[model samples]
Target: MRRGAICAAGLLVALLLPAPAPAREAEPRRAPEPNTLVPAGAVRYAPSGFPDRIVATPAEDPSSGFAVAWRTGATVDTPWLEIVEAGDSPDMGAPRRIRATTRALTTENGAAHHHRADVAGLEADTLYAWRVQGGGTWSPWRQLRTAAAADAPLTLLYFGDTQNKNASLTTRVSLEALRHAPDARLALYAGDLVSGGDGEDDDEWGEWFDATAALRSLLMVAPAAGNHEHFEQFEDTPRERRVLGAHWPATFALPGNGAPGAEQTTWWFDFQDVRVVVLDGTSALDMGTARAQAAWLDGVLAGAASRWTIALIHQPMFSPRQDRDNALLREHLLPVLERRRVDLVLQGHDHVYGRRGGLRAGQATPQYVVSVAGAKQYRLSDAARDTMAPVAEDTQLFQVLRIDGDALHYEARTATGRLYDAFSLHRAAGGARRIEEHTGDRIGQRDCPRAATLKGRTDRCWE
Candidate 1:
């Protein structure tokens, strides 16, 4: 009788409670915004009558000559370049006008003309101001200095892939690097300058140019072709293939003394005491130019007369990612590097920072470095973590190389201009090389935890 009375009381309490609220419907899912590096309502990259995208490239003999390339509207044909020795007077001196070789190109952004001028017989280590003419107007004079004829102290800037977020992230890194080494003689880029190479992403090229506009006009650029520089052709078919993008040839006037088929992509130049050899790893891997480029590298290194030899390529021989090992590069190019005893190998495509002193023990001739200068970051492979010392991930970096006498000093700096790694390679008079690490006081390695799922999503560690 007591239990029944208790149950009746509970039923009366439940009946008095308000009815349960109806289930709230899920809000409609919003579509994700477009993934674009360009900002809203940004100025279009369309070419005007005035010249744009001006750049200076090292000549085969940089001591006496250099090449300049620019872009203008398609209608602005018959453009020319004017050069004068920089002097203290505002009146300046008489300028020498050189006719430009213009090539008409039709890109996804419409039609434009690319002009190249080869200015030769300039004084060594002398500064010259030059400009290009388009539609009867002259571009602002840009200054470039010739390489010294003899071996001397020099400074150079090296950057990995500036492939993504070029306008914002890359611009900061590039400008910071310029601030750190404003007088860098030559800037070496390890390819993948832009993320897209499908011929439709012309704006990316413009962003790349804008990011490095200051440096390009001031220093010589030596760049190699990364895989991303190749454009897809005959898409969605078995006959589909990759070809070198048209913008590459239109952008920089590289020394055309490379492999026969890959002349524009692979080349070498002498800048003071350093011999900068740029190889087309993309072609070597995809286009079956491995043996040819390897042979060329061997011959170039064998006949190198410079005090220092530096090789620039896109693919890393010792990849920071275990799955990214390039057997083709290792088989064809590694032997050439080891046999030639190249002093330094600067590479990209790993999207991580790794420095390997030598392939074997008690050897320090070749120092392999893979770095990135873009927003993209990759997780270091387990093998890289175990073997590659002083490594970093989730960091954008640039390297400054200063060569004084027999010693080469290298410092890797973050986007904020903080030194992250440092080292020095000293070459003895007897031809032996030694490496000294200066990374003791550098900031700790930047890394992040691997994603927990196959979708590859993780929080950004750089922030």
Candidate 2:
């Protein structure tokens, strides 16, 4: 037979074999117990006793390190993690098993547990797989790609408030944002990741984790603690005060480089030429974290070596509501931020969509934004209108940031991927910054229809 005829026969023979179907993921995890407060069958990805709420928060140096946190049943103690470098082959060979630090967390639902573990000395720009184990059961494998080398362009997704709506309902915004940017390195939660204060409201957190658990499993999250996630008084003991939510600390493994008293709650980390600093404004204004956080903020910015520096907080220094203002943040934190000349600030609390490049000493210094991801919406009252030109009202939005050496491009999109606002910060030759606005097709503002009620449920009109 000729060569062509022989090759054709082999191809015909291979076609006789069947291709295998892909493996299916297990039932998505859910809340351990029902949250009766929320109506039955409202909106939720129920939590399971098995490993749930998997998340990786950026470590001090995200280039070669990362950390994960998860939850399990109280009965399952001694949480553990198994990790390995992934390969093209189907079987992932012997993974290194490391035991995690477990803590018992009793919530409104019932008694459950949370676990966390930090992995360091990882290879830069590598791919790895990890899963947790409890009660002799292991979670499905999830893969993570480490940060690229310094000087490389970086991209990340930013979210405002995911509070007030069903945990699952609000989660769609994050998943939607992630779907739009397949190459996003990390996700930023600018506070109010969950509703219900003092961490006693466990059901809501379950919604948050279950809604975006799959996405969070792979990407590192640079998060800030929001006011709704903390409170000075708890219902259990009205007289006593809690610095942060009961479940906040046990939820994620964040960086340790923070103020003397604020560790993971308020910390800073470096990732691919970008320095991210998370500040606890709740603690700063109400408690005694102002001076300390301010001092630490100045020090961090003073010694910052990254090309871009960004601050993430819960409350905005420039309030969008006429009734409210973060006076302490303005008086203490703003001075340091101005002095340091931080590039961008991401914040929540006002639940309105607004941005500004307020002038300082006759030059555009920093870009500040207050956005919301969940269904709750608030009308923008000025957003420091004198400083912000194109402000918005009653919107649910997310932001995506792209960073290179000289410019940082930002886009604010609605939950359904509608671009409402955009801007680019260009660095001039001698430390001067210029802002360019890009307001694409947008609904601009949302209004309550004649017969609509957003009192308890997430408003679907925005979506």
Candidate 3:
């Protein structure tokens, strides 16, 4: 028989065969769901106990590397890595495994842990598989693809706040974003990855990680510190000590280059042709520390050599929610960004979705946006008329960003993958930023949940 005929006949035979026995089922059972909060005296460590967090290093070196992080109940036994080309395969399947060494360390939380297995020796624009070893057991292999090394067009994933109902619906959004933009080089989270403050329970953060498991293989996260990350001050605590509770550095190994006085809270690094600068708005807004990080922002922006400069922080200067505007950020950081002509600014905390024309210091650079992911919803204020674009309310959305040569394209997608807003920024040889808007046919509309339609009210309107 011909090759095509034989292939068809083989498929027919497979279909004609009796169904496999129930005992031969291959679907693996889901991970155990831990109690939301540990009992008063239980161990209460990381619920999933898997190597939980992974982030991409924004290095411009030949040895492109991504940092993989996981917390275990006990010391990991020789954390190893397995790698293979990411391709069409079963959810769990055989892959080539390689041994990678692990280091041990301890944190203030009384958890003796291991760190530093920086996965190096990776090819640019190539997909690689990896996993961690917790003693005799092994973790599901994670897949990661490095960004393109040279100056070329690239794509990335941007999310606002994945803080509310994070475990349930938020994971859907993150997975969908990855599903839609699988090759996204990096995923940027503009703060509020969780709900609690510095004394955060590891389990809460685990939910955030769970929401993004499907993309964990290819997506390396870069997270900012949102207001929710700040701890409330006790009476006797010193002012500086009360600001941030030091949990951030313990969790992720971020670039150490931050504002002079704000080293631990602020940072900036370049990736390919873009320089990403992150600041702790809680410090800048709470106790008048804006000047210090603002100075650092100015210096970083002025020294940037990348074609595009983007700033990611928490609070928004052009918030659509009345209760959450950041007057201090507008006064401090905006000037530095304008002076340096930064291309994009991504912020969250308002729980609403907004994309506005750029503001030099207080006036309107090229593009500024405040958005939200997860289930939290907020009502849009009347200030929508003051901006160039529309202000979205009662919406949970994610953004897919594309950088093609001299232009950048942004599309805001609803939780279910509907495009609600679209815009672009163009960079000319030497000039001010030019902004253009697109009204695509992919628009969607969602209204506030009616009382009868509501499930249960915790806080916001979407309840």
RMSD to the true structure for each prediction, in A, is: 5.8, 15.4, 14.3
TM-score of 3: 0.78
- Candidate 2's TM-score: 0.84
Model 3 segments more than 4 A misplaced:
1-50, 54-57, 60-63, 77-114, 119-123, 197-200, 235-241, 360-364, 442-459
Candidate 1 lDDT over 303-337, as tens digits, reads 89888899999999899864787899999999999
Among these predicted structures, which one has the highest lDDT?
1
Query: Which candidate has the highest TM-score of all?
Result: 1
- What tens-digit string does per-residue lDDT give for candidate 3 at 1-463? 8999999999999999998777766778545332234445445444224554544444433226665555554455446656566666654456555454444443324454543455666677777676775656667766666776547777888899887657777878887787688768778889887776434445556667677766665677778888766667774556434456445655665556788766766887666677888888888988568999888888888888878888998887677775566889889988777677777889888887777766444432547788899666766666754653556767778899888777888888988888888877777767445767788655744545544215444345663
**Ranking of predictions according to lDDT:** 1, 2, 3
Q: Candidate 2 lDDT, tens digit per residue, 1-463?
A: 9999999999998898787778998988543323223665343333346888788988888888888888887887767798899988868899887788888877666677788888888888889988888676888888898888887888898888887654546667777788777788899888887767533367778767766664686688878988888866665775776567678888888777888667758999888888899999888887777889999999999888887889999999888755788889988899888888898988988777677765464456678888888766665564355556556655667788998888898888877888888788888887778877776655454543423233332322232
Lowest lDDT sum, 10 consecutive residues, model 1, at 454-463
User: Which residue pairs of candidate 2 clash?
Assistant: 30-46, 30-47, 31-46, 31-47
Better of 2 and 3 by TM-score: 2
Work out how many backbone clashes candidate 3 has. 9
List the candidates ranked by TM-score, beginning with the highest. Answer: 1, 2, 3
